[model samples]
Target: MFQEKNRHLPCFAHTLDLTASDNENMKPLIEKVKKTITYFKQSVNAADELRRVQPEDKTLKLKQSLPTRWNSVFYMLERFLMLNKYVASIILSDSKAPEIMTASELEEIKEFIQILKPIESVSKELSGEKYIYHIK
Candidate 1:
């Protein structure tokens, strides 16, 4: 599906089971993360620039890891989780001092942080294995 939609940015590692779905607890936070990713991905040039300035070995590793492995479920979720964690942290840190963000902005990102931390914790526990979350 990604290949059909985004052939130019064909990193086959994206074919993982990484869809956002409604969870009684996780839906809103996951939606926030999805919104952040949409904003981030809009800057294709910047992502490429990040890849370029990265050390050759690091760049090669990223390309080899994803562009080559194209079908690893662990790799895709790991990558997405990594990005989501970073964005959440940035939002959290920026919101720490009230002056850095408007009241409404701080409130929104505060909610974002609250939602994301649990998600981050669960992902950390899963690591390279599949998770089976059961709601009580």
Candidate 2:
């Protein structure tokens, strides 16, 4: 409504720019995740566990994985959960079985996940899996 009086349907495309500056006050968890995942990959058991505990995306839905090596981008705030889960499975056994996160890291991850919950979720159904609302 602000521009040209509805000339466009107003598709909202702006995401908060997280990387334009390294505001340490706001983004330390992202840095922590990158470090944790890097450490997790240093051993074989951890790597195998990451392969096993993926969210069970049977449909072969793909995602950009950890870089062949870590970099500044690996520490970006956007992909923290991918980093978090990868580490958790690797370091923790599958019985009780999720790996533990440090208290502060867990808190930050929860906050980010909550903020992102509205975007989309993958679901499975008789028609096969796709992103959809929980109809039940």
Candidate 3:
């Protein structure tokens, strides 16, 4: 039998996780987004305020990234970007709300989302049962 070390292979999903988690430049901005999301999630009043201000047809809300899931970051950022206007309004109106993201930072998030979209799509495809693995 082959040695266990030689036979063992790293998981593609894990590698993707590493790629997302190891982005040092995004850490600070991600932390800020996380904190803002957490604050809104934890504060009933803030969440209610956000919901109240949001368009009746637009029920989408903020999303928080999960440490264990690599694609969660993409979802979180996507949802945040979608709801940015409402979030900014909340932050402006509420004294207790976290600081709003700057225009440049929001643009950075947009760019980061573009970078992550393919990674997220690939990860999902890899996880699907229909995904084909061809040995080149």
TM-score winner: 3
Query: Residue by residue across 1-136, what tens digits does model 1's lDDT show?
Result: 3468556632221322222112345445434444544444555643454455546764521111133332232332344443433344444543331122234543554554454455554544455456444445
Misplaced by over 4 Å in model 1 are 1-21, 52-55, 59-77, 84-136
TM-score of each: 0.31, 0.40, 0.87
Model 2 scores worst on lDDT over the 10 consecutive residues at 10-19
Q: Candidate 2: which stretches are off by over 4 Å?
A: 1-21, 55-79, 82-86, 93-100, 112-136
* Candidate 2 lDDT tens digits, 17-121: 222223365356555555555555464665566666666663121123243312223234445454555655455654423336676767766665555343322
Error of 1 at 123 (Å): 17
lDDT (tens digit, per residue) of candidate 3 on 1-136: 4477668545687688569756899999999999999999999988998899878997878989887776888899899999999888888988888889999999999999899888888877776646545555
Worst 10 residues of 3 by lDDT: 127-136
lDDT, model 2, position 21: 24
lDDT of 3 at 111: 96
- The local distance difference test score of each candidate is 0.40, 0.44, 0.85
